[model samples]
Target: MPHSERPSKRLAVVTGANAGLGFETARGLVYQNYRVVIAARSEHKGRAAVEALLKDCPEADVRFEALDLSRLASVRDFAAALRERETALDVLVNNAGIMALPQRELTEEGFERQLGVNYLGHFLLTSELLPLLTAAGAPRVVQLSSLAHRGGRIDFDDLQGEKGYDPWRAYRQSKLAMLLFSQALQQHSDAESWGLDSLAAHPGLARTALFEHGVRSRALVGALFRLTLPIMTQSAAEGARPILHAATASDFRPGDYFGPGGFAETRGAPERARMSATACDAALAERLWQVSCELTGAMWREETTT
Candidate 1:
């Protein structure tokens, strides 16, 4: 049988898999016969999501694991748990993030909440799981980015947003970080022969819990989002297809971006996503990677399967 047609025992870890795009991604992977571990912040929701997936694909091999991306301790703990439970991990989907909040908030590690959870947390987690990923031979890492990254400007000095804070800027910076970091990681993987495929993607406008949270935080923006979401957004399942493609596609190209190809790249089939010129800055990505290492105390260079 062809490799794609053969049954796969590959194990995958998808963060924020309790709902929305993450849940859909997990469901799709499980349907492909991949053993999926749904990493969610809420165990109840995680189990619920697994049950839902089972309902859709009763034969799917899926389970839930607890993870809180806003906390570095949580990231470490979650990774440690995975190490105890499994020897190798084939795919990791960094698909959980927050959008524009009404006010500035900090994560458990004192970094800006959005940046901490969306980029730094995932960064630490990925580094922590490098050993497992490498042990799995051919592995893939998919970072969830966003269209907001086009307008994002990383303020190196105020990375924590101590001086001033803008919700959109913070969210965009985190998303842009995901984009840059994925590309940089792919380059590093090639240099080290890590046998890892790193990719990034956006979901355009998807009808997911993300906007529900965004609306709750800021009523005015929420109203506008509510007004426009029905007309512009696609289903959560449709939005997750980009991530599913990045993870399951046989081509295995690193840094390949994917998203919807319809109007404004919002509501169509999965394809190459658009990004800003800044998203291609290797130097900036390196700097951000360095700073992330400093902040999270996760030294990716030290990671090895042996």
Candidate 2:
């Protein structure tokens, strides 16, 4: 279907809608007439964000819902709530994610913090919500990734960073896993005629709380980030455009990746960006899919296989 022809009355669920690219993506979707559900980890922040969005766009159909992607039970509960409330979901933006934290942490579910929240959590969430997404004529799943994925390696033996952990390395691996998952999802959907579009996008380098979160936890690193922000950062709104385009643009194809189109994809307008070679590896994509299924215990394989 053409982009213009896509239904405007659709419902969109955006994770991490309390701030950064997720907030901006919600705003853009609201402007485009989508009834947006802002899924956040904190009720206070989510409510505050909804109020702020309404202040700018009084008619914006935006609501807040609590979701902490680091917890599998929370993901299941969130998915169940959405299923009970809505008959169909036209767009699901797996936008909530964490970046480099100085120390390795584990989620409530016992997975590496970054991997748990950024990749595995979304993996399970999407799988559980597949019924809602599939109910719509053409649903879209947009997985938010990062350029750092270029240097990532899927350490199967050390997926949880239990053997050893470097914050940035773990973050990169998680983001790469997200990209590969999106790609695998697209391929699976196509092979099974699942009637959904799976796409990936990244916010090059945007000045968001992610950087602040990194710095606040470590002074020297925080200082370095503040020092470099002016030279490397782009506005959150600009960074979110690729995600919006991938979610709503008519030209999108399954497994397509989008991002800023300037200065090594660091800062510019949104465009169809190229993914890293590692992210495009079919073998790794399949391996990640199997591992994700084992972790989430989601019925994705059964649904697609049948």
Candidate 3:
């Protein structure tokens, strides 16, 4: 039998699963008996993550596939390959993201680095994978947003930041875009009767490699963050709770956003978090959806597989 025709267990894909919250999300999904794919840009790190997962649960169904969000071609190729091998995708965690980069950089496609990798990349990936997701009885897509989204502005005039670039501003826009995308996707799904759930989540100050190695890590802000880690941060596993909940919970609405439930939503169990006025703007989401589709040349697959 061809690989695509073979019967298998429920399947999931978690981008950036090589470490941090993404790894923990994959771990939880594997334990739940889903055949999880650890999608990351680095083959070595991806394989290592698979190894670590298997070490804990030797029978866990998990493997790695290369996916570099910085390149739109890579996103397309990854989606195409997965479609050839899987008849359905039960869950997709858009978890991979690059935090603040000190220097202004552009992706292979000339997109702002942070926006390209964090939001646009996932946008295209989810668009490409729509067919596989829709084939499942109940599919779910989880987008990773952040607290920083509150300060985000779309800045359509300078989405690429050609005029001016501030690391945190770019990061904020990307995260807010993720949240807006989640809501927009849910709306689209409802309108098209896609029968899929789309939700967003935030980790609420989790201490992960992204924080330790990102732009903030180099300055006094980084020092302060590190100093307050014990009191203000949670582990990656803790951070994954909101994502896992958003991905698997039955009671959540299609467009709900999840995050930590403690004071200022810094750390606690998963729960519905507050949304910024900008994030709730349906008009903006629609505009972004159109712009993203134009930028990535993404077309949501309308056909469904049996």
Alpha-carbon lDDT, every model: 0.87, 0.89, 0.93
Write the residue-wise lDDT of candidate 2 on 1-306 in tens digits: 113333458899999999999999999999999999999999999999999999999998899988999889999899888776777789999999888877889999789999999999999999988877887878999999998899999999999999998988999999999999999999988898778999999988887888567556767877876788777778889889999999999987788999999888988888888788999999999999999899878786322321
Q: Candidate 3's residue-wise lDDT over 103-188, tens digit each?
A: 99999999999999999999999999998899888999999999999999999999999999999999999999999999999999
Q: Tell me each candidate's TM-score.
A: 0.92, 0.92, 0.96
**Model 3 misplacement above 4 A:** 1-8, 215-218, 304-306
List per-candidate RMSD values in Å. 3.9, 4.1, 1.9
Q: Model 2: residues >4 Å from true position, as ranges?
A: 1-8, 215-228, 301-306
Clashing pairs for model 1 are none
Clashes of each: 0, 0, 0
Can you list the residue pairs that collide in candidate 2? none
Ranking the candidates on lDDT from highest down gives 3, 2, 1
Instruction: Rank by TM-score, highest first.
Output: 3, 1, 2
Measured with C-alpha atoms, the lDDT of residue 104 in candidate 1 is 91
Error of 1 at 118 (Å): 0.6
